[model samples]
Target: MIKKNIYFVPLFLAIFSFVVIAVALQLDTSPEMIVGDSMQARSFPIFLMILNLILVAVLILQFYKNQPNPIPLEKFPTWGSMILFLVFYVLTVFTDMFIGIFVVMFLMCVLWGEKRIWVALLTASITPALIFMLFDLVLKIRFPRGILTNIYYG
Candidate 1:
């Protein structure tokens, strides 16, 4: 019997990666200028895309160099987590990144055998605030608030 073509899996991934990088590179951030920073608004997206491309290349190299067997992938949240995050990502285009991050973190924690409901919920609730403090205050990065901006304006 002929061996199945597993090489296409990595090839498809590389192609998808290229498409993502192309989309990110084509994004228009010209509406506003990024101030108070050494890098421009486009810097982050461009940097991320290039990094992703580099990682794809590394993955290809490793696949060829090692020629590992195609073991069955992990079950449970491995693929589901990826799809969930992708859906949340699409939702973030309309919603805020902060809320999305909070929801995902909470969901992951709960999925990871978090026994105590109160403890799990509390950790999720406070996670966003702590992250805000660390990123917004300590790291000096601002996050979008979506509809919550008006409520928190006071």
Candidate 2:
């Protein structure tokens, strides 16, 4: 029974990837160029979806070749990660993307059983700072206005 259920994961992923590819195909391909000879907006997403499908196929093949030991469902962090994602979304919508990133990183580190509080704090702080520097300073991209971003942009 467990062996049979394991295939569902890859099957669901494959279905989701195909659905995303279909939606990506429907995206408008206007001639707006962000850079010289840039591909359409949907190109990268479609490519990624195709790659996902390929990975799903590989996973299925691996499962067939080697019947792996089943891990307990309760041992998985799926629900916790999903909840964290929802919280991150809410934080990003209300507070700021930087705030969401920092909070989520810290929470995820703790959730995954990180023992050191200082390491979690560093991960939370440094990750957002690096992201801000890379996008705001290096790439010259402006983040949407929010609590922390407003201070930086102003």
Candidate 3:
């Protein structure tokens, strides 16, 4: 039986955010020449960490206030899909992020009962490409060059 007081969700978020904030604090804060006095790279991460912490706090408070009833154990499949998504997301660090995005997006869309194959395929392909272009090109952020990246670039 799925317990209503699902403390795990908020607890996990709080722990994860705390860890991320700890790591973010260790980020290099050396001044950048071009963006003099402007926000450094670490600032964005720190900002996000703060936001995550706030969100986690709110969720924890809400959970405590509600004390909702336990859901059916049959809902495990939904949780399984979420876990699978997280697994795939983590795997992207070892492989290529774009490929991971494509695979995860397609599988998740299908799992969520999207009927149009063409729509899913197009979305899975285009969305990652746009993200790659925006971050890699426009924002000048470099992505991890895994084995596939090495082969392609070489």
Identify the leading candidate in terms of TM-score.
Answer: 2
**How do the residues 6-42 of candidate 1 rate in per-residue lDDT, one tens digit apiece?**
5666677667767776787677655334455465555
Please estimate how well model 2 matches the true structure, expressed as its whole-model Cα lDDT.
0.89
User: What TM-score goes with each of the models?
Assistant: 0.54, 0.55, 0.50
> Which stretches in model 1 have alpha-carbon errors above 4 Å?
9-68
Candidate 3: RMSD over Cα atoms?
A: 9.2
Q: What is the C-alpha lDDT of each candidate?
A: 0.70, 0.89, 0.77
Q: Model 2 reaches what TM-score against the true structure?
A: 0.55
Top-lDDT structure, candidate number = 2
What would the per-residue lDDT of candidate 3 be over residues 66-108, giving only the tens digit for each residue? 7766554656558768876786877687777767778888877
| Tens-digit lDDT track of model 2 for 1-154 | 3488778889999999999999999998776655348888899999999999999999999998897876677654677888989999999999998899899999899999999999999999998898889988899999989999899889
Sorting all predicted structures by lDDT, with the top scorer first, yields 2, 3, 1
Model 1: colliding residue pairs: none
In each prediction, how many residue pairs overlap at the backbone (N, C-alpha, C within less than 3 A)? 0, 0, 0
